[model samples]
Target: MSDARQYFDLPSPFAMKRGGSLQGARIAYETWGSLNAAQDNAVLILTGLSPSAHAASNAEDPSHGWWEGMLGPGKAIDTRRWFVICVNSLGSDKGSTCPASLDPATGETYRLNFPDLSLEDVANAAQALVKSLGIEQLACLIGCSMGGMSALGYMVLHPGGVRTHISVDTAPQAQPFAIAIRSLQREAIRLDPSWHGGQYGDQSYPDIGMSIARKLGVITYRSAMEWNGRFARIRLDPEQREEQPFGFEFQVESYLESHARRFVRTFDPNSYLYLSRASDWFDMAEYGNGNVMEGLQRIRVEQALVIGVSTDILFPLEQQEQIAEGLQAAGAKVEFVALDSPQGHDAFLVDIENYSRAIGGFLARI
Candidate 1:
């Protein structure tokens, strides 16, 4: 199949929210369905940290996407009705301008010298992409995990840009627990001898550090209830057990090992560091004079649907409640649904039936 990914060139000297800029930045995105002459039926999806622009497969790329089950011709995010677009986060390694991309000025990979990234920058880049497509206002804006925070930034930075929103498993800001976990993940990568202060090449990649960080992330992505139910003290067979003294033993350990191994090599470590730090640093409070709710109320939308899993320890249900309250205060009709899925923060991705009912029902009304 042909490549479906498209690129939008951001205006030169794109300023960063922090204290730097990029001269020749570009954003990667993909589209499904046709935009009507009015261009008012557009739906934009901002993804979590790791996902690319490929939110669903099309004729150009038939491979399944990360959200393959949720977005399709007749799925929850029906492409037949809404002109859907998914943009790769600006700082992602997935076909976007990131630390992995060569710096035009230096003729080398940005590595640690890349500008300090913020979700605001991501939001701005996405907005630029939307404008280039001739969309003045999106019919709906959908954000998941870190993408939710970015969506908040998008709404706040560009008022009246979105008519409605769907927030899934995200927070207005990084709570102390979430910050602490991300801190540890970053520390693991920085401490690895092979990291070499972000100068390591593929030959000397920080595999162990990346592996440990991914393991830690996976542990928090799902709930302890799901873990116990899935593994249930299951031990590996004698032949599968590691030969070393402190090797993998439990079935959960083996599962995490395989998951981490597959992830570490595919993702660029520098890009991960930038995006992880950006997620922690995002605070709606910054826009609200140290009040998160006040900042959220500044966004102007007609309606919203906030969904959260009860088992999500990373972004607990209370955060979703906060989002609903803030959006309601902003005069938007808000519906907050607290799901009982045991999959924790990952419930939105795993428990499709419940999510589809909520999302599809809401969209059907729209």
Candidate 2:
């Protein structure tokens, strides 16, 4: 509400959690509503892997964002009551400094040369932005998926920066199954001849492999029940299948194709590789000598909320339970909410009303 989307320039030679640092790094972000006189009503919203800083409809941009259904004036986030700040994660293709961005040293895109990124880097960059805004504490810090992992990192890195923490449909670390799936997805891209070991400049992108990878990803993001309910035994016309070499008999296959096509046009293959690997590289327990509860002990929030979808095999309800239990064991107030839905790992994205109601109720208490 204060202004449209904006950029925050991080201090030069940006340091990373890993070894190297980046030069001229900047983060793109958007804000909604006004910061109360106390600056205590600001809410930090972190997105999953592919979303931009545009979390919801705002004055400058009215288009719907990935979380459009749950944000805005009277929505779950309720911009009318709280100032919302959504920062595009570093290494994202969307407006943030990334592999696609030019290296200030060489005047060319970093591409594969970009330093390895980690969830800590994302959390640090966001915290820098918050400090730049002169905000002392956040009313709540909320995230979904990869964002949730970042939220965990933020809680540990800056223990007193946020008062409430909300993590939705994400695990504290990438589970083995999730990592294996993403490994194959990365393999798909590298196996593409056009990918040229991530230097595919001027040549055709690895669209074929990217598409295949996305198709596989779709399966993991959704539940069997949802697929069955939506595309039960439906088949495409034989003639249409013949016309399109990649066409499939099942409507579910077509759904995957549509999403893949839409994604490749906007997402950069190298950035995808980086972000996916970053997720796998994140492990919350590393903060406290491989003990999750020990790591959680570093968190200084008044309240914590963990939400998990029953059908989410990727993140799983058990993962959320782990987070809540760890917080409680560490002497923090915690609430664990289990949502039943057919949407699987993506329930937070698709089952809007359920998530909205749960999150809204939590925010009200905050």
Best by lDDT: 1
CA deviation > 4 Å runs, candidate 1 = 1-3
Off by over 4 Å in 2: 242-246
lDDT of each: 0.93, 0.88
lDDT of 2 by residue, 1-366 (tens): 355679889988889988799999999999999998898999999889889999887878888888988888898889889999999999998999999999999998899999999988999999999989989999999989999999999889997899998899998888899999999999999898989888886557899889988888888889999988999989877764646566487777778888999987588889899989999999878987997767767677888889999999889899899889887877778989999989999999999999999898889888
Error of 2 at 334 (Å): 1.0
Q: TM-score per candidate, in order?
A: 0.98, 0.97
Candidate 2 displacement at residue 46 in angstroms:
1.0
Poorest 10 consecutive residues of model 2 by lDDT?
A: 238-247
lDDT computed for candidate 1? 0.93
- Candidate 2 has an lDDT of 0.88
Q: What does candidate 1's lDDT look like per residue over 1-366, in tens digits?
A: 133899989998999999899989899999988788898989999999888999888888899988888888899999889899999999999998999999999999999889999999999999999998899999999999999999999999999899999999999999999999999999999999999999989899999999999999999999999988899999999899999999989999999999899999999999999999999999999989999999999999999999999999999999999999999999999999999999999888889899999998888877
C-alpha lDDT of residue 138 in model 2? 90
